[model samples]
Target: MSDQGNPDPTTMATDPTPSTTGPSARRRSLFKANGVPRSPREARASRIALDARERKRKREQLIMGKRFRSHFEDYEESDSEAEHEATPTEIQEINRGLAGSDEQVAKALKLLSARLVSPSAALEKFILAGECVPHLMRLIHSPNPEIQLQATWCLTNIAAGSEALCHKVLDAVPYLIQSLNPLNPDLADQAGWCLGNIAAEGPAFREHLVANGVVTPLVDLLTTSPNSQLTQTACFALSNLARNPGAPMQQLFDAGICGRLVKHLSQHESQDVASEVFWVLTYLTAGELQYAHRLVEQDVIPHLVAQLDKFADQGSAAIPLIRTLGNLSAIDDATTSRLLDHPEIIQQLLYWVAKSPARTVKKESLWVLSNITAGTKAHVNKVLKQDGAAVLTEVMSHDSYDLRREVSLGKREKLTGKMIRWVL
Candidate 1:
């Protein structure tokens, strides 16, 4: 007479526990009144529904446990709204606004950009997980310039996070590349900065950037943009693009970046711009000797020699110049001769070898001289004529093992037995 003895059919069908009657009774209860068994599709559907419900229950329990633990933990919440990570509900609202009317999209982007400006890794991860990247990528092509700019600003911050997060934003790259037009210098600058961050991830990302046609526009900005900031950003992006050893130097050469960089070295008064340009050259020359030869054809050797003399005491500026020179000198006799064409090149090398306090600079300068000495006998004479033997002897006695090793390997290998004896 009790409800347990006459359980509701709905409850019986849904419950996992068997009735006291038996397994056969429970199985019979699952069939229709006509005593036909449920079809295979119906059985499958029932099992799927049961699994979904079980999963949902478990997920809810886990979330509740996490919330309870967070509540009891010794955590101090920041008062700043920007410091706070967005909840799923809040992120969902943001996503809706992003896909909404023009006014809604603008408001959402402004809010997103403001939050990203502070560089919070947690916030970036939250936004990325919230599925905002695809929407941001869509907005990058928005006709509204302001909206496009704000969206790009958000993406730049996102890409500035870890390399894993940066990879998520790869789909936006082509759109970012298209944004690098001089007509929109501000947007172009932001886009270039974003591309630089993306390219900095690794060689694969750099290759993607190049394959997306970033070089030509970046070269245009570097050569002709009236905006100094834009030009500098372009240089930065290009430097990152060319940083890896396997970079497409031939493509960059065909784009005429080498010639433009040489002209900038001679004419640009901005030391920062010149430094960035120098880095691009260093990376490019790090490729095949043909690329270094291309730089030599640009008459880059004379400009580099002059710059090295002027900035010798400033290691930040001088190292790249020395490295570029070293890369050029390593090419062949013709290239080394072109470098030595300037009488002061050897003197500069000896000055650094004996006096420069930075071991790296000393090593690089020694590397240049070593390359020269390794050349024909005339090259060795050029080094010796500059009192190279005394500098080499001083380095041999120096405290740094690296400097001593460089001298031993470079001078001992190619120098005449007389010079080697003097150095050792």
Candidate 2:
């Protein structure tokens, strides 16, 4: 139908040799390598598919972010609530967590010890409210060492401040006394701490503690485990029970607590232990004067005198022994004479009175001398000849006129030649 109609017919009729199939197939292979589907249906459908690794990573990040936000919000809420809602119920919840059987509570106890606000206050409230007594009792039996320790600590704090709590603690005394036998040092220490606090509140709960044979366990502990603090606390508890100063004193006297205590005091191991034992002796002697005489008859004075030669360091235990000696000397003539004649003790006392900078020890020295010489002319002369009067007169410079007049008159009344002549 064109000007070259004859030629067009010829070109149309020719098929033109099949185009090389290699390039088309190579193009298809390239598309497949790039993940472009060759099929129409596959290309039209979803082309991007997520792999397991990428999906898992996204999930983990999401979870981590959620956890972080949750904790952050919780911390903020806790802070805000602590300001206004630190009520009894809220406090109890926190205390329960602090004493929980979980490892979290164990961490909390350690954290609380280092914190400004003691978690123990909340614990005390729980105990006083009567809500957690059974829980606490059960917690004492927890398999976790830290939970048991914290529970014991909470009980100690509670018993220390509340009468009701002390009664509750009385119910648990047998259990605590049993815990004393635990082979662990820290556990035994905790038990000792609990008993100490209960005992410290005085003897209102004495019969409950003693009727259950509590002393035997504590005394038994001294034989095997001699933790200074534990032993000190035990001695203090025993002294509190014996505060009545009566025939019941024979109970402790019979247990031979005095001998053991003296033995501990005489040894220069730990100053704290020695100081506590010294204080216990002071309390025991002050209550019943015979106990002071009993100590002398048992040869405790010589050992005490022997300790005088061991000069105490900065926080010397010798000070306590000196004070106890002063008290015992005032209680009995036998102790007075024995102490006055102990050369080591006399020289140390004089030096401490005259030279030591501690006004307390210095004052105790003067007072000890006065107590020893109070009723006996021989003791008075011994002190006077030993230059005790000169030093005592010096103490007058530090005293009021009333005290000076008392000392001056006391010197005249006690320094008689008749008794001095007998001794010389």
Clashes of each: 0, 0
Which prediction has the highest lDDT against the true structure?
Answer: 1
> Which residue pairs show backbone clashes in model 1?
none
User: Whole-model Cα lDDT per candidate?
Assistant: 0.66, 0.53
Highest TM-score: give the candidate number: 1
- Which residue segments of model 1 deviate by more than 4 Å? 1-121, 142-147
- Give the per-residue Cα lDDT of candidate 1 at 309: 57
Kindly list the per-residue Cα lDDT of model 1 for residues 265-321, writing each as its tens digit: 788776666666766777778777777777888888777765765676765346666
Clashes of 2: 0
How high a TM-score does candidate 2 get? 0.67
Error of 1 at 313 (Å): 2.5
